[model samples]
Target: MQDLTQAAALTGPAGGEPRLVAIPRLAAGGRWRVEAMRAISEPMLLWFTKGQGRITIAGVTRGYTAHNAVFIPAGVMHGFEVGPQVFGNALFFGKDCTLPLPQAPHLLRIREVHAQQEVNVIFDMILREMNSDSPAHERATRHYMGLLGVWLERQVAKAAPEQTRPDAAKRLVARYTALIERDFRTGAGVGEFAAALGVTPTHLSRCCRQACGRSAITILQDRRIFEARRLLAETRMPVGEIGASLGFTSAAYFTRAFQHLTGKSPTEFRRSV
Candidate 1:
């Protein structure tokens, strides 16, 4: 098994443990580390201080430029594409955190210089506290996290007036993504998911493309492959068993699908990591 304690994908706390971790946006894991479809069980704050990219959250796609902060609540599916010039930090508030936070995701474009500086200072202070060896460092970091929640609220309020409610297509895709998160491991296909949601597979795919620029089947496959990579990297489980557990009918089929999406077979991918 691999030592994945430092992996960004494992941002969720274990055994109800309270955790606060901050890491560089582009860590050593892989280029597509943060650009894959997955969901975390804790609240996350992505502070993009420089560069620009496109982020898809809750099945809605939007361009994220410099000075942007995106707050994603637990259980929301999200991913983004960033180039070499992009840089930022990802902060995770553990599952046991008690701080007040947004119930829904918020994408804030900080236009004011003061507001931009304010968020940067808050992130810096939190990071410093995290790195401190003082006995009171944990308490200090928690307080700073609270301040960040407050900052997010204020920015969200300022953007609320400009916000519009999600239309039917967005709503449907959101539901579809949520369903995917819940049952991706069960081997359910996109058609099963669409049927459960009272929609046809064609309609679901159309909405997904309109909302996130990806087809429904593509999203489903991305999610399953994402989990496959995680299992391969973090566990000693046999390759065939892992594929079966993820609803793959055969190990050979799983390998082909995994390679088609990730450019590597399971054995090769595990060894590379």
Candidate 2:
């Protein structure tokens, strides 16, 4: 066992690029934890060649095993607990690394599928580029990173759902997400959602729980809170104006709800960032 708090400290210095770091292997301790929010100033692509671990992003936690890869977009808060026995390579790219692919947003999760053999081979090539002592190492590394992007784009396409969620329970969850994205700022509640979806409130709640592992109200609140956070971070709107935009009649209520979900006042969060 290793001291979870100090595991990341043991890793060596970053590589030549200010925005990039080459991690040949994970920390020696099988377990590590980052107790606070960890922000990424740059995009990170982590390849877990071997090991199992758990990662929490935003408010969602998920498990990861061998051959798992994760892409953390810039500005997201995420942290991971890794098993000491893990072996992996981490690549950090600057904010301007490359244009994002059209389907990149959908590839948010670490799919429960193995990488194709060709993809694995390309990963090995990247490892070689990292270790090479040649003068052209920088060029080689950049080319390999581009290749990795192409491979990931293919994987996302292959794994994407071909059809809309067909199961009635899952469809309910999908529809809820769509509706929230469209009308979250309108302050629509679970009862309104149930009415619009043509289902009883109780039935809607049950369906949401069965498919998303969360109640309808909780999901709705989370969606609204997320939008609020985005506005706070990305826009210069006054707190009251932002709250009103989100359908809150009173800024006090919006402030309280935002604090409850994010553990910080909207003003405090905006200033801190």
Candidate 3:
């Protein structure tokens, strides 16, 4: 029963009368008020109906205005500040909603009148289904969300060559990410990863920079740091043991690295969470 209208997550794909898409009512004037640099594991789409504000993803900030549908990939740091006159629909899909989901954050404005109207209609239908008492509510919600994904993909396609990636770039990053997820605990560097992918380190880093908005080393650091936070919050592991297990040369090394990137020592991070 948490209010995903602002900031949230879901276990997986929605079941019924799913809370996947609903209009977020802002506090007081109209601000989302989630500014901390935290990672979300679920993919999300944000559609703004009016007003403008700043949306920062991966340390980049952009203006969000009416009819802007922002596609946020899973496992990235993002925050939002909506202006007072703004109201919008936010759709939270589990990480596995559909194939070709964006692997990075992108903001696209729905410029066509018909496309804008269609998006508005879909959001309204989703809200209605979520409130209904029908047995097939969840099924209906899934259908609508699938449609949302299709429209979003088209919008992203228009922006891919400029801000995002082409299919080839996506494939390369996908392979790199898969290898990192499987072997990050072993303390592999960009060179080792590039070797495994059969590409030079420079080539791999170029792909990551173009496709992920960050360098290859930064991506590895993020994956490691995200896991460190998860383990610190979810388990009772000792700090030193966590460092050694994550392939850090020493406990002090791990602490320094975590602090440098997250601005918090491991213990401080654990306490905050």
Over 84-144, each residue of candidate 1 has an lDDT whose tens digit, in order, gives 7778778788877778899998888899999999988988898889889999998998999
Q: Give each model a TM-score.
A: 0.91, 0.52, 0.60
Candidate 1 local Cα displacement, residue 227, angstroms: 0.7
Candidate ranking under lDDT, highest first, comes to: 1, 3, 2
Report lDDT (CA) for all predictions. Answer: 0.82, 0.61, 0.69
Worst 10 residues of 1 by lDDT: 1-10
lDDT of 2 by residue, 122-205 (tens): 667766777789899768878877887777776667656752434777666566655554566676677887887888889887
TM-score of 3: 0.60
Which candidate would rank higher by lDDT, 1 or 3? 1
Q: What's the candidate order when arranged by decreasing TM-score? A: 1, 3, 2
- TM-score, candidate number 1: 0.91
The true-versus-predicted C-alpha distance at residue 82 of model 1, in Å, is: 2.4
Model 1 clash tally? Answer: 0
- Pairs that clash in candidate 1: none
